[model samples]
Target: MVKNSGEGISKSVLYLMSAGAGLVVANNYYNQPLLNLIATDFGVSESAVSNLPLLTQLGYAFGLLFIIPLGDKYPRKKMVMIDFVFIIASLLIMALAPNLLVLIISGFFVGFSCVVPQVFVPMAAQLAKPEKRGRAIGVVMSGLLIGILGSRFISGFIGEYFGWRSMYFIAAGIMLIFWVLLKLKLPELQPDFKGSYKALMQSLWGYFKSEPSVRLAAVRGGLGFAGFSAFWTTLVFLMEDNFNYGSGVAGTFGVLGIGGALAASYVGKLSDKMNKNKLITIATLVMLVAWCVFEFSGHSIIGLVIGVILVDMALQSLHISNQNIIFSKNPDARNRINTIYMVGYFIGGAIGTTTGAYAWQIFHWQGVASLGVFYTILILIFHLVFKKSLA
Candidate 1:
């Protein structure tokens, strides 16, 4: 396949990439809503089935570190196609698994192969004109965020009406259709790094050491995500304990967050013209205010809805800004750069999840709110201290 020499990506291709990203990343979250059904089917405790999400998240983090960097060394189209095959295989295994252990293992592979979205994100940035890079990324990321927010709803509906296994079978069939579309419409992206696998891996650390912008972007994005995750991880508990609502009411909050997804592209355009550091500082402050909203309005459903909208929009804005800053530092190393940024981002999310759960056990809603504020404060301090450097 020859490399494309294009000034801008077409809307059709961009839409395809966006939809593909959404579908691929949604695999990681599908099991979240189906855990109970899975537990009953496999004759296991809910506690045991809880490990499915954890193992899948761990697999995703591993893939971000080890597999995503390969995008820099290989044709991404080929790599993505191969990953789709593996994803379909994993989904099939989950559909047909006879035991909990087999289902859990298949869950890991599903998470691991879903790094296909990460691969396409950098490719989108690479293919876009420099002035339009942030908007392009925003469009693609909107799809990714939508996938994360919507997967639970879709899976819950399908699992309730049909069965959990049916959801996997349907997802596998969708991936097969996507595979054919990608083969026909996706442009061939040439590798930028020509090196041994070991050296390619080694270069990741070099990027972290040499690129200060990458470090700052990664830290800022990570802390913001930590705050975001802290709130979401404990949201259901807050709804149940404070308002006596059920999981369905808690799930409706994800729908409210679609406002944030719709705003991502506009935010990306702002990042292109504005001072990214200032935008990040403002975004962090908005997140802080969001936590304040949660703290004061913890008992009100209306308050929770308002807070969800603010926090999600703020988080997505900061995230898009962070990517623009890092991508500007090294165009050729976008894949490696993204790997470094996202690995930190996901690690922060894991920490936030743990911290939120612990806080909920201790101080309930107040503790969770305090933890979220603390993470948001750290993001603000980093942005303030390094504003000049980041600029």
Candidate 2:
């Protein structure tokens, strides 16, 4: 990646980061639309199969806690490439998994190693101009948004046509392409922190304790992500139960999300001028509406389509805006700050996956909608009540 001292990072690198972020972050989401197909293959119940995403989120959260701080201490290009290899290995294992339990165990490693995009995001913040930091993070995060949405579209499509296992095989190949590209194009960056791993982890705890804004952003973002995860995790189940739709149709719904979700960069740029907390409040409200729409959707594809767009946009708005808040607070500590925020964010995701599965089992879509509503209200409270102008 090239950076002009007065200008900032090159356009090529921005594109690379954007695309790469989408592809890498996608590893965590590939199982959503294929949950039913996967469940059928393993002869398991939906609740049991749900462990795939749940454990993956937990793995991602653990990695965010234990590994992401290293972005601040190691040469990042080297670190990111290393993560890619680990992700590839995990994907291959899942593709060839001998049993549901084996696949679920590998899903955890997949989430653990899929932290590459987290590395890219803070790097974008570090390389961009002070005023443009939000835009840069947004650009990278937009790729993440696409990856989050697109992964489902692709995996659902692939799983329908080529078996669920083929999706993992394809995912591994795509990751390989990114690894080679970044190895050649992405630049090596000097580390900001000079501490032992133990010291680094301890420092993060201190930062989390001392930084109230980081706590707000993490909790608020996490809650919104929980809602986001809850909906997506159970979408395939809904389609199957209500419409007899398979992964292909369920995945096609992901395309609906891509349009409004692309607003991440715009939301990011807006954070530069607006109060980020307020944007978060608005996003949470929208998410609440999205769930209301979802609960009433019943068998209507139109309702699902509308709900997907709203939820994706709201999550993107909440996410990029939150990034704008925390990343702007301290440039040097960007990676450490991100670790604190993302750990909470993914933990929320895991909880949502678990809750959504439970609700879908006992109370079906209505239960999932109620759970989503609960998360959105919590997010709203975190932003509105604890509103502070940190950035």
Candidate 3:
């Protein structure tokens, strides 16, 4: 795990990695803002729209268990390149889907293949010095977070202007360009584990048991992400129903939060210098406050926009801090830890999306805000109970 800071990452290499991560990871989010459009187009119920997030998340969970483990046994750069080709094809399938069932199937492939960034995050960590690993991961992850947020706006705009199908075309094009760039710029990294798939899967439990902090950090991240997603999963509905806004107006909110999402680089640097426990504690506090802001911002678009920025800042900052801590624990095994960590995070996210939608159906925006607040408190309690172990 020895790093070479003196060599430093070149701009071309960094762009190759970031762009690859962005385009690949964007697949996870393209469905977010498009849920309403998809639901209407397919003649499905609003409740059914919830399944897209749930199924996509299940796909991500499946990938962490099945697909991502290959990073430990195969050549990652080639794996990523091959996966991008599949991502492009998958988006085409999603765009051309004839029914809701077809779209759900497309969502699965999108989630499964979008894990290329999971490979890149650890790879970036492996490439940097111990002191700079957090910063490296942050920079790469900022690309990822940006893709998640920006794609919402982009997809919404494309869907609004040209058509929802155009959203997929743009995504495919981005992935195609990313494929060419990565193949040209990214250096090969051989996998550390050369065992059979069964052996690799079995070893996951052993790795989990051996790293307590990684486990705590993973759970903490899972809960945090769940709360973070709960607000967003049902946001478009709230916008349309409560605020009386169109998809385009609602999507513009994504741009408002980009500043917070882009600050991960600074947060990563701070994580490198600050006490990990203190950083996480502060982040949770911010999230708690953000949820309260959201709860009180009911019926006001400007108020909700302000809350989104604060919540985005809190969530992204905590994400950077959590990643900094967990990835710091095991360098060679980062891919496995991330696989474990992100699986938990996305499972929580899946649950959030499902539960958030139901909460909205039952109690509307109040229910959605309540879910965020409830999870935020739950995470705080868990962090407190596990404080000794986490430390």
Candidate 4:
């Protein structure tokens, strides 16, 4: 049962909160479809335009490190509202950017501010009972997955039809509305960590050092995310160059991943009854196989569709599994544990994105596929070493 409030979650409220959180998180990803447009507008090389994704992912890592821990020390609702405002500002900046550097900078702030979903997920898990926590998290995560997958198409359409800059204007308006809903509907909670900022930062490090499961999950998710990102970061280029498709066609690939995102809702239900370590191992193996499929199918549309579905499913499943493990560790420290795991995950993503971009520039789709496989191998190796230990 849902625990903290002694009442079941109102379905409407739950869905709204989840959707709001998902929209906030989507800010981190909308640039993928816009990269080519931005390159053309700024007269920058593809690799230079690649900085948008690379730096945005990096900004997420930075926020996960510095901002997420604040969840434990402040009122979450206020923090979320504040974050929404920052997102609006950042989106506005991106919409009006005069140069590549300005757009990159705005993308960074947008990413940094988008970590609100991390806070929201943990808060949802915390409010629910241990038994319901997985499902609650699953519900919230479903929204996140939808936003991630949907933004590709929706944002791509907005960018293609109106211009890439117009997409940000729409996002900014949505964020403003979301802020009002958050302010009106969310409950207030007291701080869990009462220490000063410096002390809290130190304690965060302590938690990472002391928690075996957190470290294991972080490494596991980090590797998995790296592999997941490698394929996606370079996918647009492959679709455009090899298939002679535009961003619109590239965005349609998002549909392939929706099944996986929907499956994430069930993953938590599975986690409630299954051996999480085994599940994670299975997910990692699937990820490796998915990358192999992607590498082999880079030239075939049907092959690409199959590979995308498998890869997205594997990635989302592993993501849910990792969260199930980490959040179960300490309810009070959920924010910090998430901060650590996400920091690792996004850093891995940033590295993967950067490497994929340059590799795409030099070695083309083959290079991108190779990087995905390499990261998948790293994830598999990490699982092999720690699966027993995690168990």
Q: Give the whole-model CA lDDT for all candidates, comma-separated.
A: 0.83, 0.87, 0.80, 0.82
Q: Give per-residue CA lDDT, model 3, range 1-391, as digits (tens).
A: 2233346666566656776677677788877777888888888887897798788888988887788878878888888878877888988998898899988989888888788888888888777778887788888888887877787888778777777778887888878876887877787776788788898888889988987776777777777778767777788888788777656666677778888878888888888899877888898888888788888777988778888888788877777777787777755667888888888888888888888889889998888888889888887888788877656
lDDT of 3: 0.80
Per-residue lDDT for 359 in model 1? Answer: 80
Give the candidates in order of TM-score, highest first.
2, 4, 3, 1
The Cα error of candidate 3 at residue 275, in Å, is 0.4
Local error of candidate 4 at residue 64 (angstroms):
1.4
Cα lDDT tens digits for candidate 1, 303-356:
888888999899999999999888886878889999999888877876776677
Q: What lDDT tens digits, residue by residue, belong to model 2 across residues 341-371?
A: 9999999999999998899899998999899
Minimal lDDT window, size 10, model 4? 1-10
What's the distance in Å from true for residue 319, model 4? 0.9
**RMSD in order of candidates:** 2.4, 1.6, 1.8, 1.8
Off by over 4 Å in 4: 1-8
**What range of 10 consecutive residues in model 2 has the weakest lDDT sum?**
1-10
Better of 2 and 3 by TM-score: 2
Tell me, by TM-score, which candidate is best. 2
